[model samples]
Target: MGKYAQLVIGPAGCGKSTYCNHLYEHCQAIKRSVHVVNLDPAAEAFQYPVSLDIRDLVCLEDVMEELGLGPNGGLLYCMEYLEDNLHEWLGEELEGYGDEDYLVFDCPGQIELYNHLSVFRSFVDFLKNDGWSVCVVYCLDAHFVTDVAKFMAGALQALAAMVKLELPHVNILTKVDLMEDKNHLDEFLFPDPELLLHQLAASTGPRFRQLNRAMGGLLEEFSLVSFLPLDITDEDSIADILGQIDMAIQYGEDAEPRIRDELEDGGDDDDDDGGGDGGDDI
Candidate 1:
């Protein structure tokens, strides 16, 4: 009875929208009805059609102008405004799409939103309350980290998000195609803590050696967060990532078995009744 949704999230320039675009195209190619809800108030452009745009409810420019707030402040204001109107404006928009429709909510890239703030948690609660089985897709750029320290930092950032949101989460390493040596990314994907520790030991200060070991050990011990490589150029890669998400949220697992139309059954009965019309024979 509930609909499925993917809450696409990441830091800025991590290709959240691009990921959504690719996913939209994939669903369309396969004849799946997946709609997008743009939750980013400051979004400039979109590659896919939007089912419900938060900008229409509260634009960032409008908030900045009306309240004399900066861009970051304005964005926060817009999200709060959206939350206030979820029952009235946003609820109506969701109802228009109706139930059983898979929706992808392209969320804002601000790290604070997912980590420190409770706003997104409230948003997720709202979706769950409204009969939506929601999954969070956290994306990170594969090329963002050039060294072990950076990789560790990115991993911890993702870990923080996973802990904060507490949803059926999937971490994505986007733009793998942009990487020079894709093999360099293997350690992060499967997350070999020993390899990372060796690299970390080489880098960082002596005072932080214990710190690095502790952090690396914590990450390896939990093993909850792992990245899935996503190269939008490759169809198989996209499908593999999407398949993981679909299984996570149990997509299409609850659908009722389809039944034939009454007319179809009646037509079959008529065929058995008699082939020729009685009037024609007469």
Candidate 2:
């Protein structure tokens, strides 16, 4: 019996915190117990309940003050510090769980951690070795993906994360609730590659025409790149996204089957008593 973890990761300001908060509420509404672990040492505040916090081990402000580092530099330093002290820091934080507990780790917003760096991957491997099933939830801002070229960039970044992680990965388009007109979103949501290439080439000022076509061809070759639209305000949309993640993690497959209780009362025999009928039959 191993615990389950959903590693919520994404670019900066891409609604990772909002998604974690929404997931916490969603699980609570469904009567499912879930714990959110804050892994961002630089995170100032969060809206959800944090079961485990990295700041308990190392705080970014303290790191910045002591090491004379800025916000970004302090974040990188904190992550490196955690890596050096993983056994004492993250190991202790993950202790005392009964294996069935669900944990959602709200990771840092730095894309490098997921792309070229192995820090997060090492953490993931650590969890897996400790008997926790892990799933990577890569979120991209939907607002930034309104245009064809931007959408392509988003897709490529997501692909890079997927390749780097090499685990069960899910791409999510976030902040959809903020869309003024969803029609533009629909085009990118279910885009046809050829049509997108034509649109990108036509929209760009001829300098990027060749580049757009080449990029579009690469996207067509790899069809696994797709996004699950996320609207934090919509419960149904959240459920749908969770459903996909649940499948990836096989969330409830090990649970006991639900049984219906049998009613022990409520039948009446008006014609005769149950015991009397046996003697009166003759």
Best by TM-score: 1
**In candidate 1, which residue pairs clash?**
none
Candidate 2: worst 10 consecutive residues by lDDT?
258-267
Residue 146 in candidate 1 has what lDDT?
74
**Model 2: runs farther than 4 Å from truth?**
256-282
Full-model lDDT for every candidate: 0.85, 0.83
lDDT of 1 by residue, 1-282 (tens): 458999999888899999999999998998888998899999989999988888888899888999999999988888878778778887788776656788999999888888988788888888888888889999998876577787888888888988888889999999998888876777788788788888888887788988988998889888986899999989888899889998899886655333345655676678667763553454
**Number of clashing pairs per prediction, in order:** 0, 0
Cα deviation at 119, candidate 1, in Å, is 0.7
Candidate whose lDDT is highest: 1
